[model samples]
Target: MTNETFRALVVEEVNEEIQAGVKACTLEDLSAGDTLIKTSYSGINYKDALATIKNGGVIRSYPMIPGVDAVGEVMETTSDSFKKGDKVVITGNGLGVSHTGGFSEIVRIPNEWVVKLPEGLTEKEAATIGTAGITAVESINELERNGLSDKKARILVTGATGGVGSIAIAMLKSLGYENITALSRKKNEDFLYALGATKVISLDEFMPEKIKPLQKQEYDFVLDTIGGKVLSAILPQINYGGAITLCGNASGIKLETTVLPFILRGIKMLGVDSVQLPNEKKEAIWERIANELDKERLSTIGAVEEPIDRIEEIVTHLLEGTHSGRTLIKM
Candidate 1:
């Protein structure tokens, strides 16, 4: 593997503007790390899409690869944790952000950031789950810990068509939860229903005609991926002692609401961050995804496989919000 050049999506600053494209790069170009992996697959995430543009708040430096997720076989290692030919998964921990990421045919990452691929998942399946699925499982685990183990609890998942929301709904259903409502603006009712959402409602139906400090308690638990107004609006509607897991901010980041929901309703808000979570916790969640998640239904969650060279088009689709489900990139 000496002096081998590989194709990778490189984001760089050109004349004070951000530009990204596939380029030929050698092993020497990668940032120093403890392990080197020959990437078999990577996933297109919203954060990865933003890393391609100026002021996207994803990439911290220029001429960096922009994929936060990668799964493949180990080619070389300086650590005792892994060996050559062992399959492993890597995501977040500043990958595709402050360091060289997984948008290339080969990636070199620190040994502490890699997790051995779980037994039940294929490389492609693991990539399909990637960061989004891990976030979903983490959010659900928080809800369970807060007393959502009852299958009859009414659960609401916002941004129900996105990767995390969709996977959360499916996982909840698979876990025996009976009442799951999905909130989305897209007209993909059948798709959401196929993922085990018992009911699908549009924004018009979910949001009240007037924003209020408090509303009638409706949901026992809420999995919120769309932050901003959507989160504020849902807060007032949570039942007493209910819980809400906040993950993504696809809509916006600001929240303008009173403390009525928290002080009066006893509603708990749990924040989820998969990017910087400790490797052990991430591995535990990955194991849960491998053992508990319905693998057969994963393909139905809208994973489109693309080669490494075609990532630019998918990035555009993600930024435009026209893409549905996960986009798996094959190396």
Candidate 2:
């Protein structure tokens, strides 16, 4: 791999401005790792969009590649866990932040950050699942562990149009969940319903003019992607012994709420961290997603596919909160 050149979406801070564009690079210029992979596919996350903007706070360093999710074939490896021609999937563990990441034609990462693509999933399918799918599965697993067993139990999914929410709703339906309510600011009720949401509630319709310490019991489970006031509003309506999983914070980080729901109703708030989760656990979730989620259903969740060269357009939409569903990036 002496002088092999490839294209990478390089983000650099020049004179206090963030500038990102696809640029030609070489193997030696990539971050040092035991394995070299030829990226087959990558996916855009909200964090990836933020990394391209000044003061976005997603990137620890500039002149870096900013993709947290990648699926590819191994080109070379010094690690015992992988060899040439093996297919692998990678996400998290400082990727696209502290470490140079996967928004490139090729990527080099530590083997520990790698999970061999499960047999049930193709590279494109796995990339489409990506980090968002993993987070959704993990969140559901946590809820299940907390006694979410009733198929008819009311479940609310916030930020319902985004990747995690959209995928979670579909996966839950496949698992025989009968009652799923989607909460979204966007007017995409048809899309959410197509993904099997039993009901679609606009954000305005779900939020009360005043948030009380406790409200009438509504949902038995809530999958919250947005934080801040939206999360604060959902807490009061959760049933006794219910649970809510907190994953993405696209709505803002600060959560203003009371512990009355916990103290009075025994509600549980589980925070999910997909990025720093152990590789072993990630593998389990990936396998579950690959096997339990129907490929045909997965294909429809986020059908938009964009090449790396056209990423800037999507990035703008993501930052503006106008984008919905997953967007797969072709490497």
Candidate 3:
């Protein structure tokens, strides 16, 4: 594959200004790694959208490929874990951040970052789940590990239209957990209900007329994707001994709340980070997504496939929060 030129979305800083576009690049331009992958699919994640912006803080260097997730077949390898033509998937571990990522037709990365594509999933199906699905499952697993039971546990998911929130709702329903409530700014009641949400509420309906340090405990568990004021508002209303998984900052990053909820209610706030999770845990989560997640329902997560060249349009939609569900990039 030496001297081979392929199309990749390149992000560079010219005169302290950020610029991103699809360009023809050779194998030599990629960073040094032990394995080479012929990319088949990638996903448009929120972080990937941010990497294209000037001050998004998602890219650590310039002239880098900006995709946090990829699914493909191994083209060459120096490690014993994979061989030529073996299908694999990779997410996080500095991809599109500190190193060259998966926005290219070819991606070269460390063997340690690759996960053997789980059985019972096609390349496109795996890419559809991508990092968002993994993060959503991780949040649920953390809650269960800490003491979230399926029986009679009233769960609330914020930002329910986004990838993580939507997938979490479906997965929770698949596991037989009823009484799921989804909160979204958009009026997509039909979509949310089809994803198994028993109730759908808008932001204006969920937030009270006045802010308080503590309110009536409305939910037994909260899967919060929108941070900032939403998180602050939800904390005080969590049931005693309940837990909240904080996975995203789509609404904002600032948290203005007190300790009364924690001290008096004994509620737990679990922070989840998919980008830096270990490979073993990632593989485990993928296996669960493949085996346990309702395959037919999982396929209905509103994924739309687009070519790599159209990534800019998808990025614009992501920044404006106009799109729902996952966007798969066929590399």
Candidate 4:
């Protein structure tokens, strides 16, 4: 392991097909970064799965590492922000998409993208509450607490079984939001309950209840992961002045909706792109997740701490929609 060469999941395009596998590579050949990390953990994300398949176009260059989350100890550093042996977590900031990412034994990244492992979190804990956890926390926080009613506010979280959705349920529960509905495939009902979902509804069951450009005001706030039609369908149902933090496109990328929700109902659709958010904002969210997101709940939401090999399997399963909950990749 001490050798200059280490194993990595390399994604290369061949004859119009993107192929990925574990290969040996040297540190000098890795992506450019100001600091080096002896990766202790990482997570399998949807974007990582895209890198291994043809037509995803996730990798800007060939022979790329396709993982977005990394948590580890600093091995070397040129930036004053971190030192050797310091624990840290990283996600997004063009990580697996462009920069060589956490799918390898080691990762070198810009110091600014790093968040020092805050109190109340370990390498495994940080990875479980990786970008997904942070995104949920940030989305929940986007609602300004300006003397607004707390528990009385209704919140709906869609795609509750996915990484972001599950964590959002836990976060809202911890923050005292009780009138919450979690939408997911019926098979994940038990899993959503374990993650503190008060009410779990089948994605299939919820659909076809009613469809309208504007319906009865229901949820005060909505956290939509299954965007596209789901969002188009839910937007009009949101209570006037309510907000929906748009996160993922798991349902569909193309949005088909009218301005009825935005104009007629005075609804809001806040786009949350975890990949390109400010580094400082991400660092703040990581710290808040450590402090406020509640560790006990995070672990209960299917946190698996395993060696890096698990990441390869996790990424594969994620693409197939088989991997359930969060996977913390330990190196």
Judge candidate 3 against the unseen true structure and give its global Cα lDDT, from 0 to 1: 0.91
Q: In candidate 1, which residue pairs get closer than 3 Å at backbone N, Cα or C atoms, i.e. clash?
A: none
Candidate 4 lDDT for residue 290? 75
Task: For candidate 3, write residues 1-331 as lDDT tens digits.
Answer: 6877999999999999998999999988788899999999998888899999998978877888999999999999998987999999999999888889989999999999999998999898888889988999999999998788865699999989888998999999988898999999886998888888999999999888777999999999999998988999999999999999999998899998999999999999999999999999999999999888887667778688899889999999999989898898997
- Highest lDDT scorer: 3
Tens digit per residue, CA lDDT, model 1, 35-110 = 9999998988888999999999887778898889899999999878779999999988999999899899999999
Winner on lDDT between 2 and 4 is: 2
RMSD value for candidate 4? 2.0
Q: Candidate 1: list runs displaced more than 4 Å.
A: none
Candidate 2 segments exceeding 4 Å error? none
List, residue by residue over 177-296, the lDDT tens digit for candidate 2.
999999998969889888889999998888899999999999999999989899999999999999999998888999889989999999999999899999999999988987799676
TM-score of 1: 0.97
What is the lDDT of every predicted structure here? 0.89, 0.90, 0.91, 0.80
Better of 2 and 3 by lDDT: 3
- The TM-scores, one per candidate, come to 0.97, 0.98, 0.98, 0.94
State in Å the error of residue 144, model 1: 1.0
